[model samples]
Target chain A: MAAISLRRARTIIRKTLEKGQEMGLKPLSVIVLDEGGHVIAFERSDGASPGRFAIAQGKAYGAVMLGMAGTAQMQRAEAQAYFIAAAGAALGGQMVPVPGGILVRDAKGRVLGAVGVTGDTSDNDAAAGRAGIEALGLVAEV
Target chain B: MAAISLRRARTIIRKTLEKGQEMGLKPLSVIVLDEGGHVIAFERSDGASPGRFAIAQGKAYGAVMLGMAGTAQMQRAEAQAYFIAAAGAALGGQMVPVPGGILVRDAKGRVLGAVGVTGDTSDNDAAAGRAGIEALGLVAEV
Candidate 1:
């Protein structure tokens, strides 16, 4: 898989936060992780809760690590917390099954990384995450 | 700015442990995370309890995530435990809003990483974290 450039990661974060601000969301945290599940960039908007990044990282990590978007993983996790937790424990406790985590795919449909957003309602957060990926003309896995 | 070097991270860990030992504290574990809040290095002194690394990394991750020291995060977390817990639930349980987490900033004032020390008094742990950052002439964001 191709690597996601730091520039692209920064752009994703910048645009996501911008969208959050424009939407008048309370506050937001965003994180970008590479295909290998390593953090590429992270940011928490002013007034965001201290725990926002952890949640954001979890969402993104889950999306990448499970090869599925966090929105779906959240459903699975909710239904089977014990099983999910057991599986997530292996990933340095960074799995977050939530709606705000989305995968970023290149034109060739190869996943390059993931973007996670948190703060507002889950649906809004997911929208912002998807918007960020689309801003760069990249695909956000459905 | 370049990524934080593992050598520097190890130095921070060594100095942190030295401080813990000088205070005659219990076995300690330390974690160093890069700018992206990724663990760059970690160590658990002899006799340290299991799960020390998780606790140490959680503290550091909390500090970096909120752009505040874990000491302060712990304070806020106490007042809003419910909110923080709910938010943290998404991150696979890596958020620890407690003392002993300190930010590491380069001479340029850029966040380089964070140092988290665990297995000692909160105040003592925080002090050791600061000591480790100071040893490298790096600013520990108060």
Candidate 2:
């Protein structure tokens, strides 16, 4: 499995914050997780709440575990609320089906990991995550 | 600025268990977290309790966040229960004061990350953690 390099993960986070600044959005918490849904890098920008880190991490974990973009995963969670709830109980309470989660793919379309952003509107967060992936010259599975 | 490699984290977990076997301890759950206190790798050996992951993660997070080994942190928590409780409430209840967490350090003694082990006596767990770090030729700041 080709993992996301720490250098690349840092770049993704930096670009994500830059995008947020460009859009005049709130300070964001960004997390980059490995393909196994473990965090590789994380940053909570100034003015972002500490809670944002947990939310960002959960979003990234869910995105990678579900192998889908945040919006789609959230839609599924909404539609299958009971199932998601039950499944979350089994997964040690780490699932988050929010709009900030986006999958990162290499040039060959292989999933490398997922990046998630929080501390803004869900749509804006998702957009920032996608922007980060694009900024890395990688494909976004959003 | 060096990040804990996934391969090294895996090795830490494996060697930790090997130490457990040598010491005749029960199956264990181990977690490795980045300096940012985010889970970078984890494992639950066979026969380990299902809840070990959560416990392991909490110990690792507490150790890294406090910049002290789990045993010392747990001791401080015991002596200053009110402070730990107040802080935990402020941090969204993610704090755990246990004896299975240890910090990982580079050869230069810079804090790199933390390792947490569960499912054994706290002393044994801490010992296994130190062994794992030593096996990797890394400093265990316990």
Candidate 3:
């Protein structure tokens, strides 16, 4: 398992936010973490709502923590409020398994960190997040 | 006024986490907010208990929203837990005014944003945040 460098994750977020702006989406928040689910960087755009970064961070961490994209994870959890609350609590409210996450992979397809975004509609949020990953010249296979 | 770009904010977080790991501190939760009190990015390290992001973001937002640092905002708002909680809730749990945020600034003494860290003693969180800002060629002026 090759460790993802902090520099790489940082570059992904920087370029993604820049790309998101070019796409004309609402300013979004992006979070990247190493394979171990630790935060690498979190970025929100100016004029974005406050604390939006937390949602992005939580979604990224949740994806990495669960070894799946947040979109799928939410499906697995379904409408079980108790389960959802428990999951959120287990992650200290950062396990936001929403629709805006994509797992980053190395050339060998090894799972690296995950990138999550929030602040736009679910589709747009996912688009921004996916765009962030793709802009880094990496494939999410999302 | 120059905004805190996602590129720069992510750099600070990654650098700070790397430094904290070297120091053997607990995995920390870091929060960054633009000068307008909007989140730019954040991270919650693995093994970092949940809930830190909320507190950290709240502190960062409160700092900028109040036109003061987290500590000073807490000093003024300490007498009003209800008010603080209400504010935090009103902002969807993103308003934290704890003791871990610093006013991010450029060399010209212009304010850019605020960075806050958690998952340790408040003082330690503040120190880690400061370390990241300094690493980014900027100052975390209190």
Residue A106 local lDDT, model 2: 88
Which order, best to worst by TM-score? Answer: 3, 2, 1
Arranged by DockQ with the best first, the candidates are 3, 1, 2
Which regions of candidate 3 are displaced past 4 Å? A77-85, B1-31, B34-38, B42-101, B104-113, B116-141
Please give the distance, in angstroms, between residue A86's alpha carbon in candidate 1 and its true position after superposition. 18
Cα lDDT tens digits for candidate 3, A1-142: 3655545666677676666777877877777777777666666676677767667777787787778787787776786657766877887777887788778887778888888877777667777667667765677733
Question: How good is the docking of model 3, as DockQ?
Answer: 0.33
Q: DockQ, in order, for the candidates?
A: 0.17, 0.06, 0.33
How do the residues B1-142 of candidate 2 rate in per-residue lDDT, one tens digit apiece? Answer: 3667766876788799889999999988787887888765566665565467667888888778878777787777889989877766765565667778889999887888899888899889989989998998999865
| Model 1 alpha-carbon drift over 4 Å, by segment | A1-142
Q: What's the residue-level lDDT of A106 in candidate 1?
A: 92
Scored against the true structure, residue B7 in model 1 reaches a CA lDDT of 86
| Tens digit per residue, CA lDDT, model 2, A17-125 | 8899999999887888777777555666654654666788778877788687788877887898887677656667766777888889989978888988889899999
CA lDDT of A132 in candidate 1?
A: 84
Report how far off residue A11 is in candidate 3 (Å): 2.3
